[model samples]
Target chain A: MKCYYHPDREAVAVCSVCGKPLCAECAQEYKGKVYCKECLAKVKEEEEVAASKSNVSKGDASKSGASEGVVPKSAVSEHTETSSTESKAKKEVPYKGASTAKVVFTSIVVALVIIGLILLSTMGISGVLTPLSLVTSKSSSVESVTAIPYEGERSITVSLDANNCMLNVKELENAIDDKVVKENTEGAKLAVLTSVNTASRMSYKNGTLTVKATGLKKNAVVNLYLTIRIKEVSLESDVKNASFSISLPDIPISAKLSLTNGGISLSNCTVDRINGTIMNGSVTIKNSGVTGIYLKGMNSQISFSDNKFLGNVSLNLLNGTLDVKGNKHIASFYEKGVNSVINCDFSKTEPPMSATFKNITTEVTINVGKQPAVISAPYADVKADSYFTVNGSNYTTPNYSKQYSCLDISVLPAGETAIPLGSITLLGGD
Target chain B: MSDIDARYMLGSILLSLGIVYILSNVTANFSPFWGFIGIFLIFEGSYYTVKYVFRQHKDITNPLVTLFLGIAVLIFTFHIVIPTFTMLVAGFSIAVGAALLLSGFVFKISRKEVLSGLILIGFGFLIATPAVFNISEKFYRYLHIYGVGALLILLGLVLMIPRNKKSVKKDEGGKSDEVH
Candidate 1:
């Protein structure tokens, strides 16, 4: 039979309420009864109207009984029970027809909202729908070099600000003979090599070489080959191929470096002091010597290997790893942060190195040298080797004496009322 | 408000307070963003709990799911055991997917729920297994960003399409006459 709603379509079912021949699109099943859309709406409206009339009558009867002072609590209970049952039944109606349409509309809206949120979070407010350009092989390469002559300056200060690029700072093997510098001139040089997609600036003034590079947007598509190569080493690939190589004269200079979403490598450099702040990157300092060191990092992997600090070393980390390996020596070391893993091998370190750790939920491993060490960790769960004598909140090596040069180690809570949820492992070495 | 709703609200308030106190004491730097998310989950969990307890909802699945998600978020904020954010998300996804799949089999839910459960399980595995097995990151990113959204759109479209209904007389062995 032809359908009621669409005459050209074949009828699939007959509405139980009105006996209308219904197409699939116009038929709805409710309480095991197939009804046409119109019949279903009409029946529901009629039932609601009847229910309202019955409720009105009940209200009138209750009022009349209350006025006559003969109302019964049992009747009120029964009335409430029946109303609740009706409400429950009404709530059991599954989504059908118009309600299903509403769900689809809502889903589309939600999908759009989710897409918008992702764009906003990854791409920021500007350039929401810009085409992805990070991965394109057609982008041109841009290179810039800046050289600063050493004009009787005893100490040079190097400052760098970079984003989404690899930064390397190394002592010039030939301080004056580098091709980037003049033959007779002896100075530092800053060379920035990057893609056209990124923006970089370099300036040298008053004994400081300042270099800045901004990376591409976070959500930009990356080249598959480059991404795979970088991702294997756990590096961000949105910058395509960008790097800043700074060659400094082998002198006692100081450095101040800041990075966002990039890696920093400082090797074979001598500095009076070094201060660095990195967000979302890895830091590697190998075979470097400095008088003092201060670093703050978030979501970064910081490592110091074969480095010597004549002064103090202060590190603050959040949500990352810190590894101090090889022959590392510091006059004093202080670390403060949360949710990080720290591994320090001070077996080859010089004596009289005072180290203090204040953190929360950070796993710490320290290997003590031949020097006698007195370790105090009140907040941390300390696991010490058998070579140490255990006192209350203190672990002391058998060779600990008041007159000897000792390593003073202390682990305390980062803040008041903060519970330390991490463990500390102390390994004794000869 | 009904008695059950009032009690649920009170319970939610107390639970939020407890979470705040614990988070403040446990984490060195307590992030407000994750804190708000945890509280939001707690409220949702309490709402579903009330629905299940008062017989307003027919099944315990929703309450259990919400409760697990809420607790997991709270624990993530603490940042004690879980090492990285990616691992936390992967673990949570895998756990929720497993829960959904189990509930689908045990409760005999609708076909849509079953499909959704299977999809979530697949996504969870896709996200978690890649790091261990050295899967390509570009492929993972594409799948994570576009594939999930496309699936959601497809699901919506599928739900919008109308299905053919069976003849009542044939299905019920000539029950149309009785109804008439």
Candidate 2:
């Protein structure tokens, strides 16, 4: 084969399938017109109706562009006679191919969607989201918080009508290195401003830190942190206890937090594991993705809004209740107790999670799909009723172990009432 | 076959091979028969692609179709491959840690994402961490029904409910209202 670089003569080559003189510069390639210059242009003017056409029902849009200007009037010769029905059927093909092309694109998008779902489930969605730090102002005070930010020291500002500044932690450390990040500061120059009035007071140990400030004046600010590896850090404030405001950036880790007394708030926090207690305080968790989580409280009801969950989740109540609304679901739940009530609408959830409960003193009314998958408590008493509901498959655990179905029954002799949980066996599975 | 065509075919073949290989790796339960099936499909795809470009320089199979199938195959592989691959990555990360420990300042120059870098390191630990719990009371509340219903359903009703009881508005003042 001699090379003809942009020659005027139509470059021809042998077709691989049928040894025909195929014109390069106008050769048919891909699924389109890639032919000799002149013939390629001609092919463009008139697509081979016979070649691309297949048997599919199509309207008469074919005669528009190509056929009219395609074949030279003098060269109006038809070759390779096709069956009349075949030809008609063939005419439908190019259009079918066009439709098929669209379907192929759709299939691609769908495949991508399915793959994305798989990846999300397995790889664990990136804990990466905007920091949950938010500045909000009420009549006199505002609060903001973040969890698992950077490993080093971080600072945040809060609004309250108490002390000018409160120290959250005097010493903080990185879990990996156990490096001392923050330390004691006597009369440390704190930011001027805010509600409460108190001098900076702090004490630190291996993994615990204590900061105290009372009589907070308006416009004061306090900085908070895990303080240490956060072995067990508790933020509880009474009427006189100084309020702590936390702030940090998004950390790609999971955390289990417990709260009592004062309000605990956090934003943009993602967790893989958690079991928390809230009593006599409000817990506000936002933008957090959890695999398995539980929040239980009495007297002080806990509510979660704008939360995302991935796996098994449940809330039990002996006195107060729990409420949550957001974009996620429970794998399953099992509940039991009197006066304790379980209510959930499974239709709003993504996964098909359900619950089973032996409502002793519980009044359970949870919604799954359209029907209410609820079971009521036996006692139905106001005082001793316990109610529980969760999103997970039921499994019979060790007969002695307390099957989470009972909300208020803590004193029962251990027997064979264990519920086996087996649906989500994966690490992140509920 | 045109060099450009052959190169395109090669690229597609490589991509398809990657998908096939990944699929092979992740399957929890794999049979030699399925492996052969996957191999055959990939090889068949590659073979036709090469032959088309080399012999005829025209693709007989639709590229879009082939691309879709390849992606599906890759996803199938990802589901199977990642769990095992996680270990490999974990080991590699440990090695990197060792290297970093040894070559501290040397690696500091890649300060491009040092903040993110530290967070990621912690996150890796987080991924391996077991959950923690504290003494707790438990309550379950799905109280948004009233709010959601009020905002969504009742709001819709309110929006649809006209403020005007029976008064014809200025725009509604028609040409003729006289009854014969």
Question: lDDT (CA) for every model shown?
Answer: 0.50, 0.37
- What candidate 2 gets wrong by more than 4 Å, as runs, is A1-168, A173-249, A252-260, A332-338, A356-363, A370-430, B1-180
TM-score (chain A only) of candidate 1: 0.38
lDDT of 1 by residue, A79-168 (tens): 676666556545665424554334334433433343234334433421212211111111111111232223332221222232222222
What is the docking quality class of candidate 2? incorrect
Report the lDDT tens digits of candidate 2 across residue range A259-351.
334455555555555565544555555656556656565445555556565466565554555454554555555433223434434444544
Candidate with best TM-score = 1
DockQ of each: 0.03, 0.03
**What's the distance in Å from true for residue A74, model 2?**
99
Residue-level lDDT tens digits of model 1 in B1-180: 445446655755665566555433322223446655666565655455445444343455675566556556655543322325555767577657655665576654656666766787687677667643433343565787898899999999998998765544544565363222
